[model samples]
Target: MHQDTVEKIEHALEGWPLLDSLPRECYGFHYRALCVPIDDRYDIFSYENAVIHKSVTAYYHEETHEYKLRMQVGFVEFCRIEYITNSLEIFGEKLSKELMQLLEDMVTFNPKNISSLVIKKGICDWAFAKELPETLEGYQLFIKPQQPVKINNGSYIIIDYVDFTHASDVTIYYNMYRDEFFGEARIHSIPDVTYDFDSNELVELQEKLEKHLVPRMREARQAADAAAHEGEA
Candidate 1:
């Protein structure tokens, strides 16, 4: 990417909002779990056994009484599971930034040591429109069609937006049934490209988000709102 291109991306990303941290007394946590099976020694292992015999990584802050931990043992060295907390008690502070740091370090540190990678986060039992708004505000963050699949309860859809070469496309999952929306980005392998890895990664993300996702979201929200108003009139 050229310097001008890099500058453009950086400027656009600023338009997107940074996610807020979950309140200290959040109903529950939204976390990201990564799976990297460095070795396949524990093939065909029983799930029950793995649960019983788990490995744990924990961190505690005595001063603030902040405790964070994750427990899981590699099944015959077949899988290395780790979690980066999205929302937790970190001395009344949000752990998003810290979590992101951990993710970048772990993945890049030993890309070859891992076999598979997964990133997932959610707010369980969410309440729809009342809590999670349909309006998506940003430059070009939403996808077109804005279709939601109707279900027994309400509706939900996952929008695949943002491209980062080798990694999975960034996603925005919306659930009307649950009245919740989750945004997630995951990478299995680093892309072989030109721009600066450190500076350009987030910039690229912002560019795609602004270029594609935001506009679609705004359009959907407007249509939905208009329909609601027309029904009332």
Candidate 2:
């Protein structure tokens, strides 16, 4: 890979992952996963593959008020086969307004440290699909959390979809296991998600549904169009 290209890529990252090793599948593609540090951080990326290959969704525990960046990578055949946590919010000292803005990529942060990048396996979670996407669509969702889990991913449910066909909500179930800092998954609106595409790019109907998407869906549902609920997957 060209040093200049890597430098330019790093220049955009707020902070990169602590990579443990080059991913086995990174054989012929120019792909990267960046763990940025905005107030609500995300795992932003650019890839030759344009499907919803991987994604993340985060939730803050109000009682603790700490942030959790849930990480999920996708396989063509499976929904959430693997996951990892990037950072825990350290409400350390309040960052300067300038710094906070910088974190959100409102302003650029020097990615000169990009080449020194890494992808460490932080907290890891493995959830197998007990129910098929087609069948898990009823308001009833049952996921068997890992027994030795270190993080409470989410039992305090937040729903972004309320009206799609039972089959339409299956992707959301898979995205449930994705970590938020790696990449964002939202319900697609203009066009519904496609199954033949990669998971990363597969869903474009709506995305990052937790924040604005869910609220938008609620507002749209009042008009009797539950279609707003489908988002980035």
Candidate 3:
């Protein structure tokens, strides 16, 4: 990228605190002709935090003297919004405004903001409705889960639960006989413990897992270890 273009981007991004606060290593620039190597065609700026990842890229078309700016924001491995514009000013201003709003929403999000139907549908079709619980979870649940897999008499969908400090995978399933929603931690070698919930208890189950699952798993593991030591003795 030319010095002039760099200056324009810096000016456009002025007053954007989120991007500005990112370390210098997160910023990258590539300069080459449109026909050159595929990797050197655009200048990219990217940043990733616990909850979201954001990126902005600029591609200049020499033939038309036009600049294409692409901005994207989303949770890691989940839902995202991509905005492309030819105006550098719009790219900077729009992305900054939208990001600020997103940050505000994150702080104020709650499960009550979403409908019960939406929650049920999101869990049933997690591959498609990954963003429905962002408010309740306070982070982007972008990690794609496998399609619902059939078991003996029911089906289950697994989705990722991630935060700044933990990654606890969860499986949501339906019991054909019981007609209930069941959730369990996807831990290895742990005793089987499944919580049954109704559609209304969906958010409550998530809250329980987020707050207590880890500690519960720890206690279970300790008990198992003690039992094993006794057997050895």
Candidate 4:
């Protein structure tokens, strides 16, 4: 990480009282989670069961050369803001604006206050398949819509497809800020796979799963089942 990059990020975070005082760590421009105090006075209960009301983290990825800003308002609710830019000035400006908006939203945040219009538009645009055959590639496919998950300062509609027979699943969501479709898959044996597709390549998501991910998962699941039965015998 460059010194200028660090300084720029710190500058963007200037007015954020919660994050301003925290120190930055090395490994790859990162800040540990900053927990927000319970009230305007920044006071916290000293009990052992204190629940984290809100938290935020910001970091820069070396491989992607992108800055990621994440804020979690409550349990199971979060927003991710990302920026891929070489200009430190631009990064600072964008980060500052997003951080300010996120903090403002948190002042009166409600987990259930998601925008249905945003969700509907995202689904209409990104969903490659609303309904798939009950079975595909010898595995039972289960498909359904998920509650919108917050991302990039707005709600993102997600559709999930599960191969119950093979213990695998693929979740698809649209990144409005990036104008790209993102697919995340969990297979039985291999590490999780995440891919980003251009808006035009939406159909390729299904093709990739049917040709590659599903078969691999089937093979891994069958082998694991066989091993378990063998041990029982």
**Which is the leading candidate under TM-score?**
4
Runs in model 1 deviating more than 4 A are: 1-116, 119-206
Q: How would the candidate models be sorted by TM-score, starting from the highest?
A: 4, 3, 2, 1
State the local distance difference test value for candidate 4: 0.46
lDDT of 3 by residue, 120-227 (tens): 545544433444364233223433332332233343333433332233233445444454456554333332455533333446655655566456546444555575
Worst 10 residues of 1 by lDDT: 40-49
For candidate 3, the per-residue lDDT at 56 reads 36
Question: How would you encode candidate 2's per-residue C-alpha lDDT over 1-233 as one tens digit per residue?
Answer: 33443344346332423232223233223345543433423334322222322333332323332433333323112111122222332211122112223222212223331111111111112222222232222322221221111113321111223333322221232222342222222232222333321223212212342234444434333433344343322
Worst 10 residues of 3 by lDDT: 29-38
Candidate 3 residue pairs that clash = 77-142, 78-142
Cα lDDT over the full model 3: 0.41
Q: In model 1, what lDDT does residue 56 have?
A: 28
Best by lDDT: 4
**Stretches of candidate 3 above 4 Å error?**
1-120, 124-146, 157-172, 176-179, 184-191, 194-201
On the 0 to 100 scale, the lDDT of residue 210 in model 3 is 57
Clashes (backbone N, CA, C under 3 Å), per candidate, total 10, 45, 2, 0
Model 1 Cα lDDT, one tens digit per residue, 81-177: 2322322333114334444443333223322321221111222212221222233352222222122221122322234332222222234444443
All candidates: TM-score: 0.20, 0.23, 0.30, 0.34
| TM accuracy, model 2 | 0.23
Question: lDDT of all predictions, in order shown?
Answer: 0.30, 0.27, 0.41, 0.46
Candidate 1 global Cα RMSD: 22.5
